[model samples]
Target: MNIPGELYFTKEHEWVRIEGDTGIVGITDYAQHSLGDVTFVELPKIGADVKQFQSLATIESVKAASDIFSPVSGKVAEANKKIEDDPALVNRSCYSEGWIAKIKMCEPSEKNNLMDAAAYKKFVERLEH
Candidate 1:
């Protein structure tokens, strides 16, 4: 539920921090809270291609395993190796150190499909209602 104002969010609950053409992706804080303790992260390879809304990685928590979809189509340029070794980073710092992948976007305009913090907050609110 910690939807920072700087990031964009997908309906799938993925968050993206866009820095120029590169975007850092992660599950929202709300997602990790719902998932409970994270135990494992299956990351995409550095050079792998992932399309918008496609499954890019998987995370296993105490409750269940979940696929993390790409927020935008792009080539994965890097992954957070720390999460593989200490998945709790996701629980502790979902928006920063716990980021899953860095992508070099194939279509920057896909950002338009994402929701800003206020919009996403309302979206989550609607889901609760």
Candidate 2:
């Protein structure tokens, strides 16, 4: 899987790329690979309040439907409309173009609860077994 070192990961397979106080969130590469060809994405509304580890969006794929959880609590600042139009972008480039939402962080300290890339890689390995 493509687990970028700079990002933080959740046990639920979401990732957060922190930029200042904003967190760019998305399903991990491992998540997209397991889900198969993505067909639809239901994103949170702008200004919606979300909680850490709570359901932020729902993604439907040929294999299954899965909830994308927030790795940090915040208000939804932006949702990627590109994924709404071409859901397959998730399967193509989950880390970049497939990012689901941008959150204006309510508590940056919540980041301490997340795993680093190395830990997440080990987590994914355990899942495979």
TM-score of each: 0.97, 0.98
Colliding residue pairs in candidate 1: 1-30
Candidate 1 Cα outliers beyond 4 Å, as residue runs: none
Q: TM-score for candidate 1, please give it.
A: 0.97
| lDDT score of residue 119 within candidate 1 | 96
lDDT, model 2: 0.95
Tens digits of per-residue lDDT, candidate 2, 1-129, equal: 789999999999999999999999998999998899999999999999999999999999987888999999999999999999999998899999999999999898998999999999999999999
Clashes of 1: 1
Question: Which 10-residue span in candidate 2 carries the lowest summed lDDT?
Answer: 61-70
Candidate 1 local Cα displacement, residue 15, angstroms: 0.4
Error of 2 at 127 (Å): 1.2
| Count of clashing pairs, candidate 2 | 0
lDDT per residue (tens digit) for residues 1-129 in model 1? 689999999998999999999999999988898899999999999899999999999999987999999999999999999999899999999999999999999898999999999999999999878
**TM-score, predicted candidate 2 vs. hidden true structure:** 0.98
